[model samples]
Target: MRDPWVRGLRYLKGNLFSCPPQEALAHCISEDCRMGAGIAVLFKKQFGGVSDLKAQNKKTGDCAVLRRHNRFVYYLITKKKASQKPTYESLKQSLVAMKTHCWENSVASISIPRIGCGLDRLSWEKVSVIIEEVFRDSNIRITVYSL
Candidate 1:
């Protein structure tokens, strides 16, 4: 279970994907759950009433921070879950997936906030381990941000 990335791969949506770091706003819905009334409303506003048709294929998109930087970069890769309380191992594995994305993009330095804390409702300590473990053996450098 220590290999959070591997475990996540097994469970993260079959069509898992990532986009290069860029500036854009995207809409999302939990494939794991039917769109609630609240989420549907937001989705419609995001895609011009497409929520009623329910045709969005990409959910939980990658969001880059607005802070301007030369080399260093940041991204928010959203994950879908019915509930916020996921096992530590799963959350760790999820971060591993994100770390892979960063590496693929030739990102040498990374700054990710306290993942699984905002809506995921995870503890910072455990989240740190998930992040630290992902980049520890790799060549890329990383710094995690949190409250």
Candidate 2:
């Protein structure tokens, strides 16, 4: 186990999609992307499609794990309704679920954007704490991108 807060995590400022691909790319998403904005656009364009994301977002805290271009990407449903922003509790729970899935599946590394900080209107300071707390002792390496 490594201390992700100290040395296991990398914080990079760039487009999340432009970074080198990793085993997984994790980000928060609404139950539906009918509004069409944010990272959903990239997911729709580059990652095959978001139909799976739409299907999986039926419940709050639902996680849609998809394989694209031989890599895994996660869409954590932090928002229950399409119109509402995601809540901190939902984001935390989603991350916990994702962590469990990744550990069980032996995912070595994951790249993520600052989840819940953009359209969801949450604080990165708070969400970062939750992410660090969830993955601090895990063997997986994490890279959080800002764009």
Candidate 3:
């Protein structure tokens, strides 16, 4: 894949869901999982639904990928356990995997929060750099949202 134009990527200060509808919603999650709070709850309500996500999470392990209600939702594992903090390496690996998945699925546009920077306690500066490194060459539009 050729390098995507830097200008193709965007950063906006607003609710992630408020942006124009995209093909996918991406976010960080832990291996010891629960879509209980924060944005996860909204995702559960909007896309995955409780029982379906719980079952999928159990069957798929850490990186749970599901298509629901005509949208793709990804739960990328950034930490091994709930009590642990998210690791930069794990985040990077997941982002790379996500890039590959997006390419395979022809997902031209995606919206993601500042993954690993909130409750997971990872640094946004580092995570943002990793996102660029992983997706900069992919012909995909990425929107990073802040709320």
Q: Please name the candidate that would achieve the greatest TM-score relative to the true structure.
A: 2
lDDT (C-alpha, whole model) for all candidates: 0.41, 0.77, 0.72
TM-score of 3: 0.82
Off by over 4 Å in 3: 1-8, 49-62
lDDT of 3 by residue, 49-88 (tens): 5455456553222456778656677888777666677678
Name the TM-score of candidate 1: 0.45
* TM-scores for the candidates: 0.45, 0.86, 0.82
Clash tally, candidates in order? 2, 0, 0
Q: Write the per-residue lDDT of candidate 2 for residues 1-147, one digit (tens) a residue.
A: 543344456787788887666558987777764536777667767775566666664467767788887778887878866578888889888888888889888888888887888777899888888888888889888888876
lDDT of 1: 0.41
Candidate 1 residue-wise lDDT, 3-31, digit = tens: 22432211122211122233222222243
Q: Could you give the candidate ranking by lDDT, starting with the highest?
A: 2, 3, 1
Error of 3 at 40 (Å): 2.0
